[model samples]
Target: MNILLWHVHGSWTTAFVQGPHTYLVPVTPDRGPDGRGRAETFTWPSSVREVTPAELAAAPVDLVVLQRPHEERLAAEWLGGRRPGRDVPAVYLEHNTPRGDVPDSRHPAADRPDLTLVHVTHFNRLFWDNGSTRTAVIEHGVVDPGHLYTGRLPRAAVVVNEPVRRRRYVGTDLLPGLSEAVPLDVFGMRTEGLAEELGLPADRCRSADLPQRQLHAAMAERRLYLHPVRWTSLGLSLLEAMHLGMPVVVLATTEAVEAVPAGTGVLSTRPEELARAARRYLADPEAAARDGARARQAALERYGLKRFLDDWERLITEVRS
Candidate 1:
């Protein structure tokens, strides 16, 4: 089967490409680090021709897998007329929270009668009405060894794209309180408002997007990781942190409640409780280490790349059936 995967999640491309069938990834015009545009146009597995009304019209695409409405307009272009392998299925992977009062069944992608929706977390699955949508839950998975060597560290960290809405989801405001008791680092796309408003010391806030090695290195720098999400669904970042042997101090909302077990970290409703748990991890490093070890064990057992691939294959085959 030739699948046209958008390859938006750069880190997961390896696993998807190595699966049972060939994957046709869309080429980007920007020839950056990720396999974007180049004159020659490299192809492996299979390269679905660059997305255009006419070019995509000719490609023998079996399925179009998307994570969101990012490519809705471009994808809609090739909706008409079929050649041979033309009337392919479309799959949308829901990777985050539902928008507004609208349910997943109302997703723009689901407007296509041939489209199937896949959710990455059960927390997200519940948000869908599923009246007009074929919904399936395929939780995020990670690739890990049987047991990982966890290093001891002093502080705790949380990863997020926007750091300013500190009080909102990702608990940006919690960081200042967290850093007061225990040192914390925020990694990923940073916002100036968060940086200016929160005024966490230079050591506390940053706008750094590190490589995989550096990301793991950042995780290894702390004994525990704080999730503290208030709005969004379970973030892939939390699972990555768990895989890195970091026990989390997260809010008991969304999938974090299910993702992090009692043995893994502390979950609570209020920010004060979260702050207390942060202190517990900070004061009792030994306990945090043990929790992290358990978290790593849980993460490896539940979320693995091979598992995700198998789940995806089953969904695709089920749609075929």
Candidate 2:
């Protein structure tokens, strides 16, 4: 299938284009959001081709994969003003959990029978009111970073982009309290000033924005992975950490409770409880290794690249048919 999609979410797109299909990614001259084309940081196969707006208008697209609400309109404009899902088969992939009003969060594609809405998590599907539109939950699948856990650093590793801006939503506030029991090494974009903002010394809570490969290696060195995020969809970083064979300490919220199993690591609402668990993992390398093994196994079973590609293939066939 020839899939038309935008380069919206990097990690998710990285795993997606790996599937067996000719992915037509929109590319602008400036490589802006509307047309970022192919990813530079992550490697992509030749099957993933870049198409300009003018070129996309002429290309034969088997299916349109819409990530954002604006994409439907953009597709229409680019595809000779043809309505998506009506004139052309289309599927709306809902990446994030609904924001703003909780109970009354109406999906932008709600009640639209023209397009099938695909949610990334079951939690997202349940929370979102899709009206009469067809919906399906296809949980995340990650490209395996291999089992790289060393747990030699004796510190908790965290991955959250723009922690200062997102703050409580990303659970940046919880880090300070958790770091009291275990040191934290934060990795993500715009995380440079996190230590100063949290009033922690550089060593206690340091932050860096490394490339994905380097970030994975750095995270594996830490004693455990810390997922302080209280809300939002299941983070790909959590899955990446598990794939790297790092034991995790995650808040029991969103899809995390489903992802992290018992003996894999600790899952609790209380930051102190998670802190104590982090301390335990820091002290016991053997225990951390044992849990990390389980984490890796579970992640592979649930989020392996092959499984993800297969699921997408099936979905694309259905949508195209």
Candidate 3:
């Protein structure tokens, strides 16, 4: 099938285009948010092609996979007034936890009968009030970076884009205290000045935005992966970290509880408890290795690439039919 989706979330899209289908990504001159084209940092298959909006207007689009709210309108404009779900079969893939109202937030696509709402996590599906919009849960899948864990660095590995801007939302504020307990190597975009901003020594709170493969390798070297996001649909990095054979120290929030099963790693609501867990893992490489093995196994069983692709295939077929 020919799928039309934006290059919105790089990691998620990287896993997505690996499926057995031709993916049409929109490209603009600037390659801005609206039309960022195909991924450059992460290796995507040849099946994923970038086409201009003018080309997309006449291109064969079997199914439109909408990630952001504006994509619906953009799709119509680009398709020469052919709206998604109405003129083309489309599904809005909600990758975020609602922002404005805690649990009372209504999804923008709520009560819309035209398209289906596909959520990456059950927690997102549960929290979002879809009203009459048909909804389905298709959990995240990542292209396995393999079990590259060494755990030589006794520091905690963290992956979050724009930590300073997102701050508490992505658990950037929790890093200072966690760093005091165990050294943190925070990674992702705009992470360069994080150490100075957080008022920590460069070694205690190191930050860098590396390419995907480099990021995975760097993350594998750390003693454990730290996922302190207060609210999110589900972070694919957490799954990728587990796939790298890294024990996780995740905050029990959003879809993390469902993602991180017992024996995989430590899950806590309290920061102090998580900090203590991080310290324990740093102290005991044996325990960390043992739990990391369990984490890799669990991640493989649930979030494998094959399963992810198969689930998407099933949904695309259903949506198209």
> Across residues 1-321, which tens digit of lDDT does each residue of candidate 2 receive?
788999999999999988878999999999998989898778788999999999988888889999999999999999987779998999999999888898679999999978899999999999888899999888888988888999999899999999999998999999888889899999999998999998998889999999876888999999899999988899999999999999999999999999998889999998889998998998899999999999999999998989888888888788878
Q: Indicate the residue-level lDDT of 112 in model 2.
A: 90
User: How many pairs of residues collide in each model?
Assistant: 6, 0, 0
* lDDT for residue 185 in candidate 3, whole number 0-100: 90
Error of 2 at 169 (Å): 0.7
| Candidate lDDT values, in order | 0.66, 0.91, 0.92
Clashing pairs in 2: none
What lDDT score is found at residue 226 in candidate 1? 77
Residue 139 lDDT, candidate 3, scale 0-100: 91
Q: What is the lDDT of candidate 2?
A: 0.91
Q: What does the lDDT read for residue 66 in candidate 2? A: 95
Candidate 1 C-alpha error for residue 182, in Å: 1.5
Please give the lDDT score at residue 4 for candidate 1.
Answer: 64
Worst 10 residues of 3 by lDDT: 228-237
